[model samples]
Target chain A: MARVHDMGGLPNQGRIVMDKDEHPFHADWEARMWGMNEAMWGPDSWTLDWWRYVRELIQRDDYLTRPYFDQWMQVYAAMMVDSGVATVAEIASGKSDGSRPKGAVLMHAADVAKAAATTRDFRRPADQKPAFTPGDKVHTKTLGEGFHTRLPSYLMNKTGIVHAHRGNHLLPDAGAKGAEVAQHLYTITFAGADLWPGEGRDKDRFNADLWESYLERA
Target chain B: MSSSYDPKKITEIHEHLHSELPSDPALRVKALESLLVEKGMVDSAAIDAWVDLYAEEIGPKRGARVVAKSWTDPTFRARLLADGTAAISEFGYQGHATGHIVAVENTPGVHNLVVCTLCSCYPFALLGMSPGWYKSQEYRARAVRDPRGVLKEFGVSVGDEVEVRVWDSTAELRYLVVPERPAGTEGLSEDQLAALVTRNSMIGTDRVLKKAG
Candidate 1:
């Protein structure tokens, strides 16, 4: 739902508070929420993109009203029940009568260091020749509706130039479906004026990551 | 395994979740976590470790060190600008999000700002979790649209002659702004220079200011 989260360019989002000393988590709940999320997610299980998609799936009102970690809490609860790791009663009562979560890739306390270093390298050798090259003009294709997409709504159908070839990587659109799809990724540079016509100067630019599927030769 | 959506049951769960959820959000979080532990989904100690890793072990200071080194060392700066993943790994700061970091230098003619616009896809290992505003809908909405206006609101006024480049970070590549070194700080040590670097400066929302004599 592009109702709330796809905030690329609409305006009037009051002052940007500059807090130089900001910590990662403001409240203990936020930290624990992060921890639980870290523990629940394993390579064999869900990808962060899937979790992000679920976050977007949250109801609009709750998405806007609830604090960040609170949103995570709700998502976690839903995941537990949805995955059959826990039931509604189990979550409500704050105790678990459920069986050991099947197919869970266990992450122990000692494994935190190792886990921190592990990141899914999206890059793979090109399946075919790269679709576009640096300096080539292209346009973004506004594909897929009602589901997760890395292609921002603001960039849809907009023109950009391929700034750099970021090699082939697992496409998030296909990865969300557990497809492990590989495609060429490019750093597409959009003239700020093109994205926000009246507001941006000619020299200003916005560079975004674009998968091959999301772009076409201009 | 039953990942089907049951609206009615989900509603009940949501109601109970919010209603019975303890007033103290932290305790409520703990309660939910304990339940997960009981269900054998997560280890309590592991949770603590993960939290500590983010809260303590990783942060902007590492990025600060990188920036300081880059400012003083031209070769490292070149490497950082060319291949941030390999450059940063020399400092022992290598991990998932650090893979494809692209260091955009702040030149006299151009200034760069970083935002996800889609989601908060930041370099967590180098810069730690993003500030709250970095993930805000307003910031996300406005950053790409009215970057100069956004900069103005952040108390950063860009000159007409200078171009403002906004980087939308993705999971594959992250951008770190190597802020232009302030004048009159030629004698400062690398560590002292690192101390002057703020998270916002690295994110390109604010500039690193020089200290008074």
Candidate 2:
């Protein structure tokens, strides 16, 4: 089943409004939320993949209706309680009951700049040969339900050519489950006509970075 | 929390209960921050530091500088296209949201556009926070299917002869489009050229740059 977050290629979305002078955050709380998110990044905290999975797990109605930061706020709350750092009661009342989670790595104020400047390397040493290389024809596998995947549903079962081999990177499917499984990533290029049929233009194409597990020999 | 505890259900209940009362996101965020701080899980100072860093130091200007240098220097342009991460690191702009960068250049016959269909995954370390419209559902859904239509709405009209290549950021790799330098800017300095590069042009939503007067 296609989750609400998988919104690519859907029809009748709306018009695009370009607000040239728009600020990144409209309110103070939004900025706080953004900072809070960045501050929570650490080894002991939830992985980015898990955070995205939780965001997708939000109920469809709330997912669609809530503001972007508000949705992130909900995800953070859920993750905090789920990880045992706090409780729903504690969150509701805005007070801790004197019980702190042990072994939680906290990001101190001094480490903020280093943390922001440092990039988390997701690439891992390759364990096996890459299944396909650039210029090879491949088809995306039909992803099964009930797991976090980076393969967008719109490209399922679609044939494309491997544009580039992106080396071994952590697969988000396993990363979301708290495991660090690495796989060969590829930039797959699909013709616009193949992806959208009669509605797509002939002079256009789409490229997506897909994992090896999400593709098969075509 | 028990083995049977469901976070999704709890979130639903919380939303349902909150609906009966006045809903204020600002208050909720404040409450969450206080709770996290009280529990010693997060630091407010760290949060403030992050907010200040993005607000003051990082943004599209960093990306503009990279693009401007690439426009004037063929060697830098080649390096940027060959390895975006290494080329960008020369400017000390390599950081979060830019782990494995792939810089695609826009030529006379090809135009490059970037979008994350699943989520709002952008080159935030270099480009700063994504715009509201870039994160909207409208752009995500239509960018992959109707590139011409979306570009037109952004006031960019790609000729039929040009092939529009939309990069869907589905994995960890981030894409940056090096837009073609606009015409009649041969006399401009690198700094002046950087000033003319807008954020939308880097995102491939705008094809035309502001002419230097």
Candidate 3:
């Protein structure tokens, strides 16, 4: 089934609210939610792909209606329970049972500054040559059944030109399963009309970063 | 306490009480935080630090500074277009969500807009936290399909000769649209130029300088 998160090209989405004085957080709780999500980061943290996949698993109605940070709160609670870092009852009651898993290292307040400053490099050493190059015409493949994929449904089975070869990076399909697999990535540029026939303008174009696995020679 | 027995007044008081109660999600977040802190799994102070980092230290100002420098320095502009991550690191502004940065330039004949259809992937390290509109369903759904129409709503009208390019951040690479240097700013300093760059311009929703004004 197509996931709710793959929302590109779906119609009837309302007007975007433009506020010049927009701050990142509207309330203290929103800030706390953002901070809590960041504080959970560590060497053994879950892959962002997994985090996104879990979010997509939310029921469609709730997924569409819930505020952004509220969705994050739901996903974080589920992840904590799934990873055995916390219990559902404990979370609901706001009390711990005084039991923690072995080898759990608490993230200290003092180290957060250092952690936030550090850059996380997602690129990995390539194991094979790139399958496509810039200026080459390629067709995006329809993705098979997978719990997580970065390919938006709108771009599937469309023809585009490889604009640039971005070096090997962690494949999110595998990363969501707790495996780190690198694949050649490229910036694929498609004519706007190709993505949406009558709706797109003649001169408009769209670009997406696609893994080699998602494309083939046209 | 006065025994006010009017049914309408009692109903109004009931509605106010319900409205004043914390939302379900908010209460859930508070509960989760309390549980994690009680279990020694996370520090409350650490959470505050994370908030302060984005709220105070980092944001669009960093991107504005880079944009300003790129406008004035030919060497820096070339370096930024060639290798965004490296050029951004030269300013000591490299961090999370900016691992593979791609700087796309806007030209007189071309415009660049960005969206994340699958998720809201942004270069937080450089541009700071994303604006709410950038992550909305309307922008993500329509940016790639009818970009000209979407831009019109943002009050930006691209000419027929100008091509609009929408970058959908589907993978690791994060994009920073280098907006066109506005006209009539030749006498302004780099700092002044940086001040002219708005967050919406960097996100491709608004023009850095309006054509009329």
- The best candidate by TM-score is 2
Q: How close is candidate 1 to the true structure, as a TM-score?
A: 0.92
Alpha-carbon runs more than 4 Å astray in model 1: A18-21, A41-43, B1-24, B211-213
> Over the stretch B82-128, how does candidate 2's per-residue lDDT look in tens digits?
98889999999989888898999899999999999999999999899
Candidate 2 regions exceeding 4 Å error are A42-45, B1-22
lDDT of 3 by residue, A6-102 (tens): 9887788777776576787777888998888888752254668777877776656667887888878777665665665665667667779988655
What is candidate 1's CAPRI-style docking category based on DockQ?
medium
**How would the candidate models be sorted by lDDT, starting from the highest?**
2, 3, 1
Candidates 2 and 3: which is better by lDDT? 2
lDDT of 1 by residue, B88-203 (tens): 88987887587788899998888999998766788888988878888887788888888888888888888999998898875478899889888888999999988888788898
lDDT by residue for model 1 (A1-218), tens:
35466778766777766556577888777888878887765334355565566666666777777777878888777666655667766766677775776666667999889878765566887759997989999999987665667888888999999999988888887665555778999999998778877764677888899899899999
The residue pairs found clashing in candidate 2 are none
Is candidate 1 or 2 superior in lDDT? Answer: 2
**DockQ ranking, high to low:** 2, 1, 3
True contacts kept of each: 0.63, 0.64, 0.63
What DockQ results for candidate 2? 0.58
